[model samples]
Target: MRADACRNLDTLLQTGAKVLARDPSASITQIAAEAGLDRRTVYRRFATREALLVALFEAKLDEAERVLDEARLTEAPIAVALHRYVEGIVPVSRQWPLDFSSLESPDHVTEKRRQQLRARLSAFVDRGVDEGFFRADVPRTWVRKLLDDLVKLAAHSNPEMEPPKAADLVVEILLRGAGKQ
Candidate 1:
């Protein structure tokens, strides 16, 4: 695809996410208007609302996967990794808050991507346990779940909160609750 085409598609997806986030029932025409593109252009790219949504969902997963990979969750100190993950994921989670379970079709690729992420997080939690950063009594899976929930809570906060602040708050809260007691 041409650079301009890619940029236009990205704009459409970004605008689609924002608009759809506010109104899931928004139509292709609404998305096109919000994206400042001709309705024919959006229709050319996405024949249906479900197609647009699927693209949006895939874009979100791709972004999140990239962020997680960049965090190097298994290569850094567990604490450092956790902070990086929270910081990186907050924006993606906030901007493209699509519920995977609600997608009409269960996407294998997306599910696999999520599983890979979960594996990295699970390993990080186990590493923390070994390093005495996390408690040994609690199951590592429980720690991972707590961390996931904390990150979600932080990302789900009022968009008014700055990303850095949200990240810091989530890390602090997770550490306080899941750290050695």
Candidate 2:
């Protein structure tokens, strides 16, 4: 695809995410209008609203995979990897805010990718625990859930916060609970 076409597709996806996030029933015309592109442009790429939604989810997964790869979780020091992952993912969580659990019938490929991402994250957490960055006593599932919740909270609740700042806040809160110590 041409550069301009790619830009338009990206714009459409980004706008679609925002519009659909606010109102899942939003139409293609509404998304196109919000994206400042012709409705035909969107129609040319996406035959139906569901296609656009799937594309959005795929895009989110792509970004997440990219962030995870960039963080080098397996090779980097546990603390550095944790911070890098948080910093990279906060913006992605903000940009593609769709909740995968809400999908009625997600595509197999998407679901597989999502599971792969989760496994990678779980492994990273385990590494952190082994390295003494995370408490070994805590259930790994709880730690993972807390990380996910904190990232979502930072991204959605503090919309104005920069990604790095949000990452710092999340890391601090995760590593050190709200205690007098």
Candidate 3:
């Protein structure tokens, strides 16, 4: 494809995501219009609705990573950092479009990102243990898994659920397993 065509494709994908995110029922014509391109141009890049949705899903994941990076997680207190990270993830999960069932299905890229986040969060908990904020006996691996499982559980199960409450429950469970000094 030509450079201009590639640019148009990117524009269409970006604007289409915004359009769908704002109104899950936005039409192809509406998306193309928002991108300042014609329907034919949009279709030239994305052959089907599923293709568009999948691209948008991938874009949303990138946006999530950007949000996490901007959070500056390492500078804050462990609990504070964890809360903010979980809080950031909550809104993303709630906002993510779920109309496309296949696109919403778990993908390798998504799993890898989640695993990376788990590692980072587990490290934070381990740091807390070293600093005496968390119990000494806690396994960092469990802390990591709890962050992944609980935040996701809250997302899929309850959009109206409080993330902090979810975080608290996860923290309590892990701490109990670790036992007090």
Per lDDT, the best of the predicted structures is 2
TM-score of model 3 (CA atoms): 0.54
Ranking, lDDT, top scorer first:
2, 1, 3
Q: List lDDT for all candidates, in order.
A: 0.82, 0.88, 0.67
Q: Write the per-residue lDDT of candidate 3 for residues 95-139, one digit (tens) a residue.
A: 654433445455666557656754665666777677776666556
Name the regions of candidate 2 deviating beyond 4 angstroms: 178-181
Q: List the residue pairs that clash in candidate 1.
A: none
Model 2, 1-181: lDDT tens digits are: 9999999998999988888888877899999999999999999999977788789999999999999999999999876787899999999988998887546678888999999999999998888787778887788888899999999999999899998898888889988852113
**Clash count (model 3, backbone only):** 0
lDDT of 1 by residue, 77-156 (tens): 77677778888888888878766654566567767776776687787788899999988987888888888787778787
TM-score per candidate, chains pooled: 0.85, 0.92, 0.54
Candidate 3 — which residues are off by over 4 angstroms?
A: 1-43, 47-54, 97-119, 162-181
CA lDDT, candidate 2, residue 181: 34
For TM-score, candidate 2 versus 3, the one ahead is 2
